[model samples]
Target: MAWYATGTVAVTNGSNVVTGTGTQFITNIKSGDIFIALDNGLLYEVDQIVSATQLTLKREYAGVTNASAVYEIVPTTSNLKTLAQQVTDLIAIYQEIPQSATDAQDAAAAAQGYRDTAKTYQDNAAASASTASGAATTAQGYRDTAKTYQDNAAASASAAATSKSGADTAKSGADSAKAAADASAALAGNWAAQASGTVDGANYSAKYYAMQAAASAASIALPVPITSGGTGATTAAAARTALGVPAIASSNTFSASQTISYSQPLFSINDTSGTGVAVLQFNSNGSMVWQLQKTSASDLNVRRYVSGAFVDVPLSVSNSTGVATLAQRPMFGTATPWDSANLPSVSGRLLNIQVFTSSGTYTPTAGTTKVIVKSVGGGGAGGSTAATSAGQSAVGAGGSSAGYAEVLLTAGFSGVTVTVGAGGTPGAAGANSGNAGGTTSFGTIISCPGGSGGAGGNPSAAAAVNPSAGVVAPTISSGTIINALAGQPAPNALVLVPGSVAISGYGGSGPLGVGGQGRQTTGAGIVGAGYGVGGAGATTSASGAAQIGGAGRQGVLIVYEFA
Candidate 1:
């Protein structure tokens, strides 16, 4: 019945209810179940089983606020383990038998010794009888021979007397030996009987105690089934098997938990042999891979599988748990362009000014040589839309840039002029190309022509005026040349163009809408293109008044010196 569940925390910060989204993990939980927050390692007991999705906690549910984190459900007490524990205790406490049976064995051994001693005595008695018989025969021979001597002399009579005395002595010794042998045989028989009676009908007292113990051991009933728990006899038998030197059985364990280990790998060569061998490998999940093997008598190589290969892991006092873990982030590679231009090989001073005016002085620091000048003519103003017609909007051309120029000086030049360019002005009602822009100069060192003005917009199918071209770019000494940005084509009235500027530095194109009568004064405006930039063009259908076009913007001159 002992079990555990894994679930995620679904809600937090509630004092009474702890909710979980996991179906199985939260469904079976009852009152008194324990709840744990994995992140903060907080433990709480369930006070009430509120519902399948919720539980009443002993206290406020507080810990990891993240509902997605995990918690473990462990049973406090259950029947599955009880039978095993009870059986184990029985095996330990009542495993021995009584020792009084050893006394019977000692008595039997004593009787055997007595029987052997009696056999020796009987052999001695038989030898004594044979000696007596021989002596009697010798006496008879002496008497017969003496009768023949009596006829010859008195010496025969004396020999017969000596022989008679010897015969009497031999008979007395034979009788004594026979008596001693009989007594020894009788004593041997008594000892043999005593040895045979040592157990005396096999004492039933031991059997009684043994039967009682067996019944007690067998009567146990477990609330749940277990491989190691059953009807008493089966359970006891299983428990007894634990006494054996268990066969290890692959990874099966005998005790509650055991520390497992292996000899560190011996370095003969690279070993790729998998588990049980001292080599690293990836598991089915590509995780939990490591090994320790002996190298020398004392050296161990700890290794792990990494990136589809095996590599050594660091081993020291810290490796007591026999685990080596690794963590890392993803990786990448890249490349960039390489050049000397824009690459700062040497340091220099370059001053920049971009304003709405024209013609300014440029003073280079003492060692100035080459000067790169970039110029942009002002933008032209937009053309104004018609009044009392459709609501029309017009766009203007952006200012043109003279592009760039790198001028080489005759060395140690004192200074040159500086110029800032202007942007185009906005157009108003009734105006077309507002005004022409002023030209800009860099004090003879360089000069920029002004941008052209835009023409007025007309609903009468007339083409709007195009902006004028900027100055022909200044010529430079060497290495770098001058180029001008392109100009925009003239815009027709009622047009649409998004971001119609730049790649050529042109301004936005006009939107397609017109205005009412001139007196109404609400028409779309066009921009002009000069040094202060061209003014914007304007349009109005006012009575008897003509709408004006935008003015062009002013030009600019820029100077740069490098050391």
Candidate 2:
């Protein structure tokens, strides 16, 4: 009946060793305890059991703490005998050992006791061999487990070293990038001021402020260094240049201005001595040509030139109409129908005459009269007279005065007139008389007069005048009339005067200064009443009617002499 058990199986938490086994196997094996043999002298450490044949064991240790090799054991004679031999040998060695080598002696004795106890418990000498064998097997398992722990620790150490090296490299790269960025920011601040030299100082200061602001705002990273002297360094340089620190005065509006002058030549009237009439005439087959020259205060006047000679036409004033005219004034140089005196200043005239500013020269409108004048008929007297008894003492109603004026085209004229119509007189004390019509005048254009009001009955009053006032001066284009004329009564119809001249004329009024009619052909007039009476004699280009003399109609052109 040989039996064997595992040797020195000690259980432990990873920290402390438990010293009892089989129940107390590794700490002190009983002599007859069953033990199995193995390659190494160390015993096994069995900590937990899973089933009858299974246990958790530690291997690779001196007294059996480590457990990597774990195996199941069955009792048998051959196995028992093998374990017994081990115990016998150990017991002999312990007894023979020196007392000075006490630890060695004790260790050997412990091994022998374990073998004997296992054999005794089974009560078989054969059990001694089996028990010793089991102890040997357990020792080998502990040794294997210890070896595994050592190997794992060595691997972990190696991995840590590798990771540390990688971390060092990454940190170095990050530091380098930060350094580069700092250097770039400093450089940008220095260079920004340099490019602004092209602009003036005041402008440069403004730009400099802007550049400083932009530089202050940015915090770019430095580039990572590469072993190959790599792409990163070049890319970083390009980025630095792109900061585009604007020039101090780059945004200024660049420009300038200049001064100019204009001039014109003045002409003088000149005359020569010698011929007195320094006039020469030529006839090329009935073609008449004349030239005249005269002496004047300023220079020799070349009055008129024809064929090849100069002619003179003396200047004189006429008393009849108070107008100055040459009987047969010969054409001057280049057959100029008009003179510079008649035209406006050269610049103003050119500006007006020419439709376009740059090109397209214009000659004045042909055959168009630049100046015209006209007259309106006088209002009838308020009271009538039996022609025979008419006397200076008789305070007969006062007659209304006639309306007259002239028109002329200055530079700004555009076929428009400034001539305003005249106002007719009101009725007199005891009679009804027709009112005078308003007359028209022209300067740059034609004008129309106002119509007159009708006369009253019984002890009749004069008609109203067409226009109540004198002609107004021409205004700029599109002239505005401050006041308009009142119209005339019926029966004593209005008449309009006509001539080649441009003028506006109003019609004559009825009794007691009735309002006159308006006419674009001549002028417009109004009539008067009550104390306002029209004068006696009235005449128009078209007609003359009524028992007593009606107010005169307006004329196309009324020429008057001023005293």
Candidate 3:
């Protein structure tokens, strides 16, 4: 039967014979085995084995050297006809040529025996030929399988190369993004740790820290009416008390109202200088016409801000209390009305003014006189720098502070709720933005909401002091001097009812003190300082690393009582 097999490719020189290494199928070939190259299907014979990886060929090979060649061996065949002919000749020679009948007969019998043996040999040769044909068919199947495997291997190699290229590109992009985040974080600092704990076992209220404005007070949501602080609580009252809010008054408070007659030194002294008066009466007709005048002993004189300048005019004073002639009220202040120096002496005041940093109660000293209350709400968190820029740096501005003021004789008894606002925090150096401050109130009378938080150099609808802004803007119900819009930007202050003279010293700047604006590549701006000022946005450079924004400031409260 024919024999054939395959082997793994190996190194070779351009010679008549090729060598291979694998399951040793080629080693089984005999002297007559034939070899065929899988690479080109060139054929050759395996004449002999030199070593495990070497072999000799029957003739000088004509094909290119292929170490992976396979070979087939033709089955051997034997014939007896030729041998019988020689044996018959020998038998004839042995017989006597002269005429011995017995000898001649013996020679003929030996010739017949040789002919039968030769016939047997020829039959065997035919059977071997049929078997070789079957063997060749099987070798053909093996060659086809090896060819398919080689084709698949080539395709796999190509795919692997493409995948490696894509992976390299992805790695490069990731590295650039991480570098940007690291730069911003260096500036943002890990305020997350700063916010939740303090080394001195104290809150920021009475302490000092540079980052206090940059870091936020970590919130520990508390239960209402909470006894003290630890882990968790149950009610809103507990949370309020935990933040230092006064305990809810037992049995509720009484409600009543009365109009305190307005009378002052302006009526008694009657200053004659009419420049920069405290009040400029606003008319519903849209003209800024109201001005004050100095009066004679009986009637007061008045001046008006007309066209563009102040103009002096005659006086007409009117009164409602029947006992007196025309009683006049001071329309404007010599400077700012609430100017601490211009205030009445302590002897004339009911006085129960106290400052609460966190929260407590507003008792008013069991007053028989009226009390003046002023408050500023907490500022918003500073904006944050993004980990990576999606076209532009995403660093936001800081929020503005909220403010409110009112005069309460006995009116604010039910007002003045708790929870003094804490300043906002600097957002993490990533997509994260600034945190918002809390709401503060004098009950129903004064609701000074906290400033809205800032974004990462993105536009935000929550403006710090836009009158339409939810809470950061300031407002007042009493004295003209109290309507100061703290925290507003220069010339853009949020004034309540534009007066001849706007309230001064009201706003304290702070929210992003205006993010770095000179250069596009600058980092975030410093936080605002006083009231209502929004934080500046962050700056981005075409070539520099990302920067972070600043933190928002805290809120405040003040009260003045007059006896």
Best by TM-score: 3
| Better TM-score candidate (1, 2) | 1
Arrange candidates by TM-score, highest first: which order?
3, 1, 2
Candidate 1 lDDT tens digits, 1-563: 23344556564554556676654544466656656665433456667766566677788764324667566654432111111122233224322322222333343343334444444444545554555455555555555554443443334334444445555677756555555545555555555454334333223333444454444334322211223332112232232233322222222222232222336522233334422334322243545455444443333454555654666554411224533232211111343222223223334433222232445556664445555555544444444443323333333333222222324444433445555545444345443343333444455554444344445444322223334333334333333444433233232232332112111113321110011111123233433211233333443432223454443444445344454
lDDT per residue for candidate 2 within 95-152, as digits (tens), equals 1211222333343344344434433433432344444445445545544554454455
Candidate 1 Cα outliers beyond 4 Å, as residue runs: 1-358, 389-413, 419-432, 459-479, 486-490, 494-556
Instruction: Let me know the TM-score candidate 1 reaches against the reference structure.
Output: 0.27
Highest lDDT model number: 3
Candidates' lDDT values, in order? 0.40, 0.31, 0.42
Pick by TM-score: 1 or 3, better one: 3
In model 2, which regions exceed 4 Å deviation?
1-396, 402-408, 411-431, 438-547, 558-563
TM, every model: 0.27, 0.18, 0.29
Q: Which stretches of candidate 3 lie over 4 Å from their true place?
A: 1-352, 366-368, 387-395, 414-416, 458-521, 531-533
TM-score of model 3 (CA atoms): 0.29
Assess the local accuracy of residue 547 in candidate 1 as a C-alpha lDDT between 0 and 100: 50
